[model samples]
Target: MIPLDEARARILAGLAPTGPETVPLAAGWNRVLARPIAARLTQPPADVSAMDGYALRAADAVEGATLRLAGASPAGKPYAGTLGAGEAVRIFTGGFVPAGADSILLQEDATAAEGHVRVNETVMLGRHIRRRGLDFAEGAELLGAGRRLTARDIGLAAAGNHPWLTVHRRPRIGILATGDEIALPGEKLPEGGIVSSNAHALAALVASCGGEASILPIAPDDPAEIAALASSGGFDLLVTTGGASVGEHDLVQKALGRDGFVLDFWQIAMRPGKPLIWGKLGAVPVLGLPGNPVSALVCAVVFLLPALAKLQGLADTATPTLRALAGVDLPANDKRADHLRATLTPGEGGVWIATPAARQDSSMLAVLAGADALVLRAPFAPKLAKGEPVEVIALAALGV
Candidate 1:
């Protein structure tokens, strides 16, 4: 069996980002940018007031000084006339500062009566004014390519006069669950048959990682059925759960091989998901995961998440992990790398304490669901006592 890192590298190397598509600015949030968003126009296009105040010449805004009220300048409405000596213009936030005005006297600092205003505080030059292009200049790069746009980025893009944005098309994934013993939820079950959960669970994982998922019909154990269903193309990547092992019933590799599927690798040195499959069926890639519910989801977190990120043109595809203290003593690991499902709790000094569940059966979905993180134990790792440091992958942080 190949090491997990090599397996992951091979899977990512076989994929390329989806092509770019133009989308409305409102729909750009959470989508990876295909092209950099350059400012179409400067922000605060001209000198504007940053606060509600009176725009006037600094030389005439001294304490106890009275100046004639010139005109009013509200947001989106600028005073046409310039301020003269001993003159002030009533200006509100976002209002353009008229020519010949170099300072702002806050309204609270000045009292206006009839046609004259008295300054209670001395005004400083260039104070409380948002200068032209203060936020961003025309032609400046506001958002870079490969970035996942956020709400703040949308606002900035709007302020930069962008009505549309170019982003990568969401990756399309086809999920296939194979087995005769498993049936869809709520379907009539044969004796000893179980409800299928891997397809929908993996579909949710794909969606959380920004990929579009399509659940294909369940393929029975027959090689012909698996081959026929897998050959019905129109997907960027195909994910199959179950039927990956060497058991007589596990026929994913055998079935796909009939359709000229080139095998990259099939096994990895990892617990609960050793019978993993990664290969190419003609132009489409296929990732066959283990049948066990826990193993399927864990493998998805390890392999599928990065594949989705790469397909979306994201700059970083590495799975993010956090450091936590072991809440219980851990046993030494063997050759296979282990992902121990554990619960996390806040500890002293902002540290997290992770305690592995007593039973970690790969088929038990309840224990996996109650887990907050997966404590990573490298192959041949030595035993550790409580309070020792450990690296953990936070599940909720990944939106799984």
Candidate 2:
């Protein structure tokens, strides 16, 4: 049996990132940028007004000075004529300053009469004026490569005049749940039938990692049937839940072996997910998860998410973890590394307390559902006292 870190490293190293493709700006959110995007044109193309005021020469813009209003200049329409001596043009916000205009006399500080406006406030040169290329200039870098585009990033790209973006393709994953006694949700269950709940969790996890899931039909215990479904289905990676043990009903390994699948390693030193299996079907990575719902999802969080991050070209693929205060007295652990189900609450002095759940049965989905974090326990770890600092991986961080 391999260690968990070795197993995770093997899976991540065996895979390669997907290629890039051109997608419209509307579809670019959360996608990794494959190339740098430069500004298409200078913002504010020319000297424009930032406020509704009068455009005039800086020398003539003074306190108590009255100037004749030449014309009006609204947004998208510039004054055709230039500013002459003692002349002023009524310019609104975003309107061009027109030639020979160097200052803006705010309308709030001025009074308008029959044919001229009076300046009362002290007029400063270049006041209320937005200079050309103030926001960004042409050919300037708006965004760099390998950046994950958020909603704000998408808006910035649009401002740079890019209607389309070159981004990394989303990784494709196929999930297969196996068991003759398993039935789909909303279906009539037999005497011993169990609902296929692992697929939905896997699909959600895949989506959270930016990968699209192809949920295949559930395969029964028949070796031939499972083997046939394990064949290529145009997926970059294949996931299987249940039937990975040495029991007679366990046939996931036997089926994949017939298709030249190379088993990398199995049975990590973990409590719930010890029966896990990992290997490759040609170039596509195959992960065989335990039948227990909690075990399958836990393994997916530990292994599957990192694979998806690497596939998306993320520079840092490590899961986020933090140290917090323990709320209970945890005993010494055995050889197998344990990820104890726990809850986090606020303590005094801005301290976060992690309280381990009393019952951590692998088959209990309710316990896993109620947990907000996993208290990591390494092999041969010593007992922990209440209020002691311990490392915890946030459940919300893994999109649970």
Candidate 3:
């Protein structure tokens, strides 16, 4: 067994980013940008009025000066007339500033009667005017590479005249479950048989991580069945739950190697999920998980999510970690790092506290139902008292 950090580093190093592809802007939300998006046009293409008011030469609009209204200028349509001394154009918001106009006096600040307008207050030059390129200039780098395309990013890209964007393709994951003791849900369970819940859960995890999950049907304990599936090489990553330990039914390691997988690490120094297998099948990465439901899920949170993020060229690919206060005292454990089940609640003063559930047995699925986070207790951790600070992994951050 190796340290958790060292195991994580090795796992991350083995994965490589899949190439990029062009996707329609509408469907590109949460996709990482593969190329820089440059602005096609300047914001406020021309000097325009910022409000409904009069556009005139500020020098001519002295205190108490009266000016004749040249014409009306609304948005989209420009008033094609020039403003002369003591003359103003009736301009609405977003209308083009008429030629020879250097200022805009707001309608509320001026009085209009007939075709003339009176200015009682002084107006400064260029006031209430949106100069060309005020927001962004043409050819400016609007978005950088590797930036996640969000709704606001999409809006900004559209404003920059980008109809489609180059983004990383979603990683494809192949899920395989191996064991004769496991059966799919809704099926009749024989004596001592359990449902194969890990594959479905892993598939959902892949989808939440912005990847496609291709779940192969349950592979029985037979080596031939497992080897055939591994040899197919139909996915970017292969995730197999069960058959990773050294028990009699464990065949994932041998079958994967028979089908051409180069092994990385077989186990990590972590509790409830010590029998993790990381390797590669053909060119695709493979992760062998424990048979227990909670153990598989915990491993997925620590390992699979980051693997997916890395495949998509994301920089911050690890699970979301936060500093949270411990609500109760915690005893230390030797040898293995523990991810204790906990519920995180927001308390007063904007702080989050984690309360570890008393029942932490890996087979207890009921405890995980109400869990919102996993309190990460490092290996050889000292006994902790209440109100002690600790690191926690949020469930939402794990894409659960």
Cα RMSD for candidates in order: 0.9, 2.5, 1.9
**lDDT for each residue of candidate 3 in 1-400, tens digit (9 for 90 to 100):** 9888888888899988878899888988989888999999999899999999999999977779999988988999999877788899999999999999999999999999999999988899889999999989999999998777789999999999998999888888989998888788999875798888889988998888789998887898888899888666767788999999998889998887777778888889998899999988878888898988899999989888888888888878767789999999999878899999999988778789999998999988878767999999988999999888999988976668
lDDT of 1 at 397: 96
- The digit string of per-residue lDDT tens for model 1 on 27-90 reads 9889999999999998889999999989999999999999999999999989999789999999
Against the correct fold, how does model 2 do in TM-score?
Answer: 0.90
Estimate every model's Cα lDDT from 0 to 1.
0.95, 0.89, 0.88
The 10-residue segment of model 2 with minimum total lDDT is: 311-320
- Model 1 scores what on Cα lDDT? 0.95
Listed in order, each prediction's TM-score against the native is 0.98, 0.90, 0.94
Q: Whose lDDT is higher: candidate 1's or candidate 3's?
A: 1
Q: Write the per-residue lDDT of candidate 2 for residues 82-121, one digit (tens) a residue.
A: 8898889999999999888999988898999898989888
Q: Model 3: which residue pairs collide?
A: none
Estimate the overall C-alpha local distance difference test score of candidate 3.
0.88
